[model samples]
Target: MKFSAVLALSAAVMASAKSVRNHYPVRRESHKKGASSELQSQLPAGMAGFGVSNTQVTEVIIIWTNPGAGAPTININPPAGGAQPPAAAPPPAAPAAPAAPPAAPPAAGPQTHHVTVGGPSGLVFVPDQIKANVGDMVVFTFMSQNHTATQSAFATPCDPLPGGMNSGFMANPNNSVTPPPQVAMQVMVSDPLWFYCAQANHCGKGMTFSINPTAAKTQAMFQSMAIQQKGKGAQSPITGGAPPAANPATPAAPSSPPAAAPPAEAPPAANPAAPAAPPAAGGGVQTGTGQINGNGACVCAVTCTAGSFPAAVQGVGSFGGMAGSLPMNMMEA
Candidate 1:
């Protein structure tokens, strides 16, 4: 009897379970259909038929007006052509810095030119004339004894030109002092300038130099004028910007003894036609190894007031070393 009671209870439990199972499926289907209908009603007429497929879920974008204040009403769809809006134009690039004109190459530095104040042949300045610009420096190396690099005017070669520069006397005869002495001066002007040895009569003997002379104002003309002036160089400081003076007088040629001729028109007499006196033999002559009056060696001879020395000297003879100073013998005579 107990076994039969147990069997009846089991049957009752089974039937109740079956009824709950059947109702669960029906509720699930109804809930799903309600959700689908609500979604379709909210969609626009154009998107009404666009529903999620059984295999895949549809994507929808909802746009709301005045965010946080209004509900979403429009659904944004991706463009059909798949084209994207161009990104905002990059902020106008800062105007390209005007291409720096290739920086002008720095102006060339002032040039330094070297000139021998007196070469081996002491009577004359080596490369006596030169062309120099305003910024250039001309170094005059006084390599010999008893000489001065003095500034003078083209019009007055031996005499100082106003506003000119002068290098004081540098007497290095026999390389007597150590370190081989020299004097230097910068070319401060572009116009023609003249220089000479101011030691006594050096200027008269053709110890002169020039810079940037014009066609009309030439080096030869200046030397000729200096020989005529026959003046000593006055003390001058280094300076520039002096107005040029009138052209100097041409130098008179040394008069030679008249050739034996018929006494018809005699040549005009030269007032100071004395023969060039030769410098003393030893030590008095600075540059070359010859007598000034020897073989027409010296043309323009002048007296030296600065010590017992040759007042002037010149490189006139054929010998490369043939320079002549005021001959002591000539001075004695």
Candidate 2:
């Protein structure tokens, strides 16, 4: 019941109040789709100890309309009064936003585009990563370079390329390598973008970077990489590919065992008969014609014969006081 009464009173209070208006400059044409808001205030009626009492305001709102290419048209209003409005109704409860710390002024009057950088590996330069703003119409030069200063837009399935929702404009610089009349694109503060050095593997070399993005997240990513490097590794979180096998042995061929014993001398005999070495099978003499008076020795008289079993030795074969017709160690004569 009380809530209903308060609502009625709030409406009545707003109906009786007066309003004032004035011009508030629009941010810029680039901020066409952008929006800005502010808060205003009204003080209590009197000075301290004299007649000051904090009163509640009824309500406050910003009414915006378009202003053409010429001087901007604006109106700042203050709510009217009847039975002192509640404190909640005037300007906003929140204070006016502090003016943005002024951006560094553009280089003295369009200085020559002395600052020149390359597109990494034929890749288009990523926008926000380049650290430029809407008014910064930068010229990026390429050489058979496939680089583009593309926008990082806020579209569903978020993409950073030719098509994007919150995209900043892009431009290509003209150089001897590129065609004449260098190109450029002025960027806006509202977008984030990324790019690569397209000549395969260039980005992996750290040829890629970004600008004026949500600074902290990138800082953490890079910082972590650095901290890890202090230990080991230069890039992402993954660690780099194991140690070898133990020693192995080979076998040798089997060898023959040494001989058992040295040879011995033949035993000497007492009456060793002259070895009748049966006439050397391949070289011997027949004795059919000779009379074997005694078998002591044999001699070669007329029938000259060679002897065997003794090299360079002469022998005599005789019996019964006659020279036996026999040869010593004979051969077929």
Candidate 3:
């Protein structure tokens, strides 16, 4: 009886221990052989536990503690017999912003040279010849009647050179209330330049100017030369700067002398040797041809009386004195 009681007690203790193991499984680090080391490496650091899974016969819920955050759960429900793939790394960070643009250049100073055109004067360019540098600008302000700053060759005083600059005629003839117009010519080249007014007889009247002239060929010399030559106005064929004058007078027709009236026909002369001399100083008559009477009859050679010959034969006349015969007086008839 004592041996049997001891055996029964040993069996009861074994049953209780097996029941406790099945009811509450103990947590343990995985140490099973043939377990995927690659799958273990894919797991995030600080993984705490896993969850139940229907598929993969091994569903796993990752409980990991993120940096500076609470522990979060990541449930991985891969297909049966398959491992869950690891999450992809984040994209590379964006580049920094670009640098600023460069600064602009400084502004230039004001223009120094200037020329006045027709100021107070009826037709003139004041201070016409001005010495200027290559970069200087010359302002031309018209202050009075018509004028132009037309570039010309010094040798050909009033004429404009090909490709030379020209400020077209600015005309304010009556000196109205409006301010005079202005045009500016820049000094691009260092050589001397000649200019003239191209309005009407302004150029002819020696309305000219020059710049940078040599000592030998100064403004005085150019003016003297221009004075001798006729002024080629703006409307000239070469420069063609100005328009034609308005309301130009029409030329009158020439008068013609009046024609003389026909002389009164005289009665046939009694002597046929010499026909009645043609009435003196009236309409001219052919000397060799007989005079025709008012009745359309021709007197031929002083022999045939008036109306004796047909009108068609009237042209035929006496050969005598025919060499000096005058033309028939058609104008008088």
Candidate 4:
């Protein structure tokens, strides 16, 4: 009965040990025959029964089963002490800072600048120089006299630049009360700009202006150069119109004078004539004084009886009376 009771207790303890080994890791150790005997002696007395010898009872065999192929671990029992302090809680997270507002944009609108041109102060741009950015405007108002705001180059301060801006002649006559004429130009770049008055001799008198001038190229220097150039740089602004006509050709002179004409010829001469006859005695007659007949012959006056005069005497004269007688018969009173 004692052996049976011991056997039953051993079975129970073995079952309890198996339960602990299955739940946690364990290590196996072999004991010597002496140690087995010592364990048997520690058991309850009178275990040698039911045909079991004491030596056989002292012989012990232990079987250990391990399901995993892992290294053995050693567990150290905690020292007698109070429980471990709770893990310190992590510091509370700092509150996030408030977000900043977005920044504002810069100004981007265009601006305008006013310039007085040719005022009573003389030929000049009231503010001869200025600084301007792109998209800015420059308006020129003519205050006195005729003038023009014409773009030019630094090299030739008075001459107009090709394809450059030009305000046509704005005439602001003296003592005029009306508003002066205005011309405007928009800045397209930030580069330096040169300008001049295109009026006669105005540029020569140093009427010049500039925009965004550098130290090396200043408005005063440009005006000085313009003055030195005098009217040489002055030019007419192109206002579309007909071109000037070309000059006519000159006439050539004659090489020499012309030739003169010849003189006329004379006529032929006529035959000579004879002398005349004398008058009869006691006859009242006139000689050498005669009249021309229808036949173009001359006849003389004489006194003679109708039948007494000879027929020869009547027809004796050819052009006039005979040598000493009347050529025609005459009667007494």
Candidate 5:
């Protein structure tokens, strides 16, 4: 709304006033090329006060330069506030408790050390790089097409802005909108850093740039990040791979004692159940009527009857007269 008012005032000034001058907050910035409205180009990292809490900004003043104007062709004015009608105005906010420290003057820290960036030919800013010292300060002031001094670093591996990095607050929604980012930038290293449009194809061609106190190996890194980003744009990510399943440990089987021997020529069932005893070699035994035959080596049950089991135990209860090996066989012989 304030911007609309400033624009309205601009149109109004173009009509009657000899030279219109308005007051905006003060700021420091750089020059750009082919810019439509008076605008400041690329700003620094902390200008919007992202990470560093010790940072501060004082003012923002928009100075429109007229082509072929008189002595003071410059019209420095603060952003106007009458754009939105009262109907559009928000209700007045209730006053709150005074600030603990109260409001300090705008000149809290060093208000100098100008940082500005330029585009390309047929563009607005040139080189489009803004660099500053660690302790130095910068002020930005401009009004032109959609532009910004994004307050995030050029992360490696081209990782998308981690959840909280890019605030998305300063990015201009529309193309021709001018959202001036008055921020203070400090180059921690004498080395330069590169930045680009997070937008789709805007930075791919030649819309990329760098900032450093001195020339170094930053250009190579920038090119590397760009290449990786381009590769990701080619195809989708890998699929069909999942973490391996865990192997469950098998439980150990319980060990058992060897089988006992069968009783020697036992009487028939009517003779009464015999108590089980240790097995004789090459023999079988019975426990509470359960007969346990010894295998050749490990005593389990039965004998070499390995190939295919008989329909019944070979000599089991021969006393029943089913097998000729019964004691009655001896009597009959």
Candidate 6:
């Protein structure tokens, strides 16, 4: 009776086990359907069909089967003919630095040049040529003889330029004057400047100077031209005045009138024609006694009666006595 009881209990347990196995398959099918639906809903819009693939489902199942595995790498390829997500933008770059400043200019300064005029070297400008810039000073110190520092033209070295500078004749005769004479000329331009001594014959002797001479117009060429000009120079200052004038001539003397004949005088009884009154004594006419003439006219030995003529004619006709009046015939003679 105990055996029979054991058999019945075993049969009952077997039947219950069969029923559980049958229900497990049906429940598993439902769970799979639900999981597929949920997976499709979670997928991005338009990617629902991607999850429907058996391969994608298997991958999902593998991922769920191993929960302890490292995170899965999902590489979602872009759909054909569909807009894709924009890639994340890269970061921006940094800024640049500033530049440096410029440099400054140099300074300007003036200078001076010294020159000797007519020194012991003779009629010349010692160091006759020099270079000078604008605003520079040129001091010309005279040494000997009478000399001048006069501005001249390059073309005509001996001739003075109109309105040009001139240090009038500075005479240092024998170089005896103290401190001598000096002339200061400022360099007004960078071009060539010609100068010469204006004293007579000095320029002709090659006494010349120059400032800023050039290759084409050198100081030697200027001196040569000055010498070729000979000793001619500007008017001399020694006269201290203008030129002089001319002279004039003199006048002649006047003539006198004739006097009336005096009363006739009787002839001397001793001689037929009174011996002609003794000829007046001196070389010129002399006064003598009166004599009667054959024509009954008074005859006097002198050309005029004493005291009869003007004072101007007193000693003109007679040597020692006053002049007298003459007869008309004698005056005519």
RMSD (CA, Å), each prediction: 44.6, 27.1, 39.0, 45.4, 26.9, 45.1
Ranked by TM-score, top first = 4, 6, 1, 3, 5, 2
In model 6, the Cα lDDT at residue 109 comes to 43
Clashing residue pairs in all predictions, respectively, total 9, 38, 2, 11, 24, 4
lDDT tens per residue, model 3, 1-333: 699999999999999999998878775647653365656555443221232222332112221211111223233233222323222121123347459645745535323345666756645666758776554545565656666677666887777655555556655565551444444434545778787876766767667888788897787666655555655332333233355567967888877877888898898778758667755554334435444656665534321222223446544765643222223443234
Q: Candidate 4 regions off by >4 Å?
A: 1-108, 175-177, 231-333
State the lDDT of candidate 2 residue by residue for 1-333, as single tens digits.
Answer: 699999999987776662221223433554433433122111111111111112321111112111112223232222122111112111113247668866767554221121123433333232324445433433433333333222222221112333321112212333233231122323334344333333334334333334445654452343233324332335443322112344676666677898878778677667867877655443343454433677655443332243333333332553344333334334444
lDDT of each: 0.55, 0.32, 0.53, 0.59, 0.35, 0.58
Worst 10 residues of 1 by lDDT: 60-69
Model 3 has an lDDT value of: 0.53
Error of 4 at 271 (Å): 99
Model 4: ten consecutive residues of lowest lDDT: 58-67
Q: Evaluate model 1: give its TM-score.
A: 0.36
Model 5: lDDT of residue 215: 46
Clashing residue pairs in candidate 3 (N, C-alpha, C atoms within 3 angstroms): 56-80, 204-231
Among all windows of 10 consecutive residues in model 3, the one with the lowest summed lDDT is: 60-69
Candidate 5, poorest ten consecutive residues by summed lDDT: 82-91
Model 5 residue runs over 4 Å out of place are 1-49, 52-125, 140-144, 151-181, 186-192, 213-216, 220-224, 231-333
Q: What is the lDDT of residue 61 in candidate 6?
A: 9
**Could you estimate the TM-score for every candidate?**
0.36, 0.25, 0.36, 0.37, 0.28, 0.37
Model 6's alpha-carbon lDDT is: 0.58
Clashes of 2: 38
Report the lDDT tens digits of candidate 6 across residue range 112-151.
4667778688988877888776655565667678777777
What is the Cα-based lDDT of residue 223 in candidate 5?
39
RMSD of 4: 45.4
